[model samples]
Target: MHRLILSLLIASLAACSHTPSVPLYRQLGGPDGIQDIVGRTLTRVAQHPTAGRTFKGVKMPFLVDSVSKYVCKVADGPCVYEGENMVRAHADLGLQGSEFDVMVSVLREELDRAGVGDAAKNELLRRLAPSRRDMVQR
Candidate 1:
């Protein structure tokens, strides 16, 4: 009886250890998927007529990497975002509401194009929505 109880306890512990919920980063396809989305979004945004102005003369690779890390952190992934905060980062850009909207639209399109599930996409957007005020400088 003692051995049986010990075995049952061990089995339950193992099961619990293996049953951790998946993080959003994994749902977004891990590091690779997040990088792809950020890269494509920045590429298209840089080429946009109205939104392109902010990206003028910016280095693409660095921006992509930084933004990817930031997004991963936001999604509860194991990434360290050492970049500036939203308000500090965009403070000098003088970003308008229209430009911010364009960015959000492009991000939505990229998320859809990447085949992200509706739930994951919506969750990410919901998590990111609060940052808009810091990004859009009136």
Candidate 2:
């Protein structure tokens, strides 16, 4: 009986180990949720006194689509990001740290508005944190 119980425990542990948690993309409500977050974030950035100037004369629909695709890919969704790499994309922008911070703040606000939980938000932020180096020149 003791041996049988031990085998059962091992089997349970193995099963637990094999269980896969849902990806963050699905946690953030998939494509629709990502689109909503991106839309709100872009709107806020465009309205921001400092950030707005950077977007002047930019093609907003293309920007929106690219950003949405990037976010979706980063979150492990099915979408693919075909846009330029971060360093290449923002290289000419000469973004300042403060401007980057403002953008992040706006994104955070939109995420919260989308009802994203702390765990998911933190996870997403962690994934995006590396892009800061590419985005900020000053």
Candidate 3:
């Protein structure tokens, strides 16, 4: 009886370990997915008059490179995000909470349109939600 109980406990523990966390990179289809989403997002944001204006005089390529790198790193892909700190990056931009919220919402929509699975979406959002805390000016 003691041996049976120990075996059952071990089996349960092993099952739990394989239960699976949503992978940040794989669900988005890895590197290709990230690039696709980036393109769609840039188009969405660019179409918005306000956001389009915000990009004026800003180094667009640099910004996109930074975004790609950041996403790649977060997704556990083989890339380094050599961008400035989140707080410093947007410090002078004077981003508003509402604006950030709109951007995030738009991003979510793009991800869905790209057929990103719910698990991946939830996991990615879980990872990025904290950024809003620092992005919005008090």
Candidate 4:
């Protein structure tokens, strides 16, 4: 009886250890949710004095779609990003740290407006934070 109980305890512990947590994509409400967040963020970015200049002459629809894909993929969603890599994409923009900071602030605002929880927002931002190196040329 003692051996059997020990085996059962070990099995229970193993199962608990293997349980999978929800992915960030699903936590953010999947594709539709990500799309909504991106749309609102872009609208804010377009109105931002510093960030808006970077978007001039850019096609809004394509930009939106690409951003949606990129965010979705980064969040571990089912979508794959087909856009240009960050380095190549932002290479000619001559972006500054201030501009990137402004964009991130706008993104946080949009995420909050979309009802994203702090944990989810932080996770998403953490995933995106690495791109700053590529985006900030100045």
Candidate 4 global Cα RMSD: 2.5
Model 2 residue runs over 4 Å out of place are 2-20
Provide the lDDT at 17 for model 1.
88
TM for every model, in the order presented, reads 0.85, 0.88, 0.78, 0.86
TM-score order, best first, reads: 2, 4, 1, 3
Candidate-wise lDDT, in order? 0.93, 0.90, 0.77, 0.89
1-138 in candidate 3: lDDT tens per residue?
999999999999999889586567768877778877876786677567665555667766677777877877777778688888789887877777767776778879988998998878877878888988777784
Better of 1 and 4 by TM-score: 4
lDDT value, residue 3 of candidate 1 = 100
Q: Count the backbone clashes (under 3 Å) in each candidate.
A: 0, 0, 0, 0
Q: How far is candidate 2 from the true structure (C-alpha RMSD, Å)?
A: 2.3
Write one digit per residue (lDDT tens) for candidate 4, span 20-114.
Answer: 98899887879988888888888778878777898888888888889998999999899988879999999999999998998899899888888
Give the worst 10-residue stretch by lDDT in candidate 2: 51-60
**Considering every candidate listed, which one attains the maximal TM-score?**
2
Q: Give per-residue CA lDDT, model 1, range 24-60, as digits (tens).
A: 9998999999999999999999999988998988889
lDDT measured at residue 11 in model 1 versus the true structure, 0 to 100: 96
Clashing pairs in 3: none
- Better-scoring candidate (lDDT), 2 or 3: 2
